[model samples]
Target chain A: MEDVEAQTHLIGDSGEDPIISKIALAEVQRAIDSLPQEQREVLALVCGEDLTYREAAEVLNVPIGTVMSRLARARRRLVEMTAAA
Target chain B: MSELHLTDEILMAFADGELDQPVAAAVARVMAQDPAVARKIVEFQQSRRLTRSVFANNLAPDVPSELRAAISAKIEAYEAAVEGGEGKQAKETKSIWGGGMSPVRMALAASLAAVAVSAAYFIGQHSQSEVGRLAQLEHPRVLQELSRLESGRDAELPFGRLRVISTYRLPDNSLCREFRLQSTSTSTDAVACRTDGWRVTFALSDPAKGAEYVPSSGGDLLESYLDNLGAGNPLEGEAEAKALSETAR
Candidate 1:
């Protein structure tokens, strides 16, 4: 699990209530689980594993451009899903 | 120029630190005037953080027991092969030594062999001058560092620090260890699999160029190599530890 302090820092929010943070975490988890397997894998490697695009490409055996496109699509989907929720 | 059109690819690349400076600067300038684009970028960043938080566990999953067993078997097989080869070679050499020679002649022969071995070692080191200085080190150093990592000890060489990322058996059943070497300005990823000893099958380096150049992560390349070799999934934390411990023993 990610450090709550780091997550707050990334989102640039300090005054967020603990209750709201918990709800947001649940929403984010649900949105991610809803992603297709390929997109989820891309997101996991690029964001979670912290790999460079070139590195992700090499790992997945796809082109770097493909990794970029998949990541873009994945992020867009997550944003849309979270907003809908 | 027409209104700056920022494609999702460009925006994502900018957010991910994958874009070169001038292009990223242009994107930033455009986003300054467009709230929609700026919001999209923010969304991407937020999603990245969320995804990272959610999937952080994937990187260090528990190793399956079957994989651990496979590794142990592979190590035993490699050791057997090495012993068999050495036994045959030693027998031939022993016969040669036993074939009677005067004591003085035997002493002279031993001296010549020593000089020849030293000359060969120096020549081998010299031949690797075109490679990085770290790559020129004796093979024993690599084995020693690998052993240290197996035993959960810190190992460092003159050129850089070594990190054993993963260990697995290749499709051909060769035991392989993937490691990363981080130096002051360069990072090298290499895969060394056992034959007679650990032989480097793949190595790639990313030397620092300028302030903007980020070192490419070695894990991806190592994973890709494993994929191509049809090496199954990497041994997880416990499996890796068990395999390393067994090999060390």
Candidate 2:
């Protein structure tokens, strides 16, 4: 019975307007959390900070190309994870 | 060049406007001719938008160092509390979050697939295997069928055979399917709703082992759960198909 109530509560949440937005945000965060730490860090620096590849490389103390490749992989993985979910 | 293979890095760089003008122009020309290439660019752009939207608040000083510092500070504080004592653990921490979250905590704050997680906790409280039965109902095979299985049809799932009884909406208009699962040992009558996924909202197993659940038509657990659910009319034909398609996600 309690389980039924909890399930009802979750289902009720699914119908509200934030269902899509909040659920998508959750999906994205979960996807990001599953990324490799290096990929996650690179993603944070690039997308979260709006940093250019070169600037991000300078901050991370890596070559500019490393930033590009990592960001590419991270972006691709995000697409795959979100779509699969 | 007449043709250039576009790698993800090249497309991403093009999307970010980080490529040289000549290269960017070339990529644009190619994208104009190739829908696949253009779609990749859009995806890269969308991925950037999504990451920024969710992660912007988590980054302090808009740097990776802030995340690293927060993680380390939390770990050190936890360790100090374990070793030195609670008194010294209250010392000033460098995390911009004050008491920063662990990665697990961060993800928890974002979202948890609560059904499965809580099922584990409920296992201890509930006698003998009820939660296990509930958790087992979440198999992809079950959901795949739930999204398409109609009343006249039956599905042979990995764990059991399934028969969908009806399709309807809850008070809040969440799509739901009532189904019965008959394994070799026991039969389950359950209501599944499309939320984050097709989750079983409530279930009652028959004590009649190896027999399909016997319906009383009244005063049963299944009936009781539905009593106040404010169920809408049972969907059928195109409507049922449309509702199930939404649950496919």
Judged by lDDT against the true structure, how good is candidate 1? 0.53
Per-model TM-score (chain A alone): 0.81, 0.74
Model 1 ranges with Cα > 4 A deviation: B1-4, B57-249
Number of clashes in every candidate structure?
0, 0
At residue A76, candidate 2 shows an lDDT of: 92
**Per-candidate interface DockQ score:** 0.18, 0.19
Local accuracy of candidate 1 as per-residue lDDT tens digits, B1-249: 556568998877766656665566466444534556666666666676566555542322223455434433433444365467732112111111112311111110112111111111112222243144335322577676664475233468776677777778665566677777667866666666665556555554552121111122334434544554456777767776776566565
Q: Model 2: per-residue lDDT, tens digit, B1-249? A: 467668989888876757665566566545534556766775676577567555533532233566667544544645466466653223222232322421211101111111111112222223336656777676778878888887658988778898888898766578778888889977777777776778665555553221111123212434534533445467888888888877765
Error of 1 at B66 (Å): 12
The C-alpha RMSD in Å for every predicted model, in order, reads: 26.2, 18.6
Candidate 2 lDDT (Cα, 0 to 1)? 0.58
Error of 1 at B222 (Å): 36
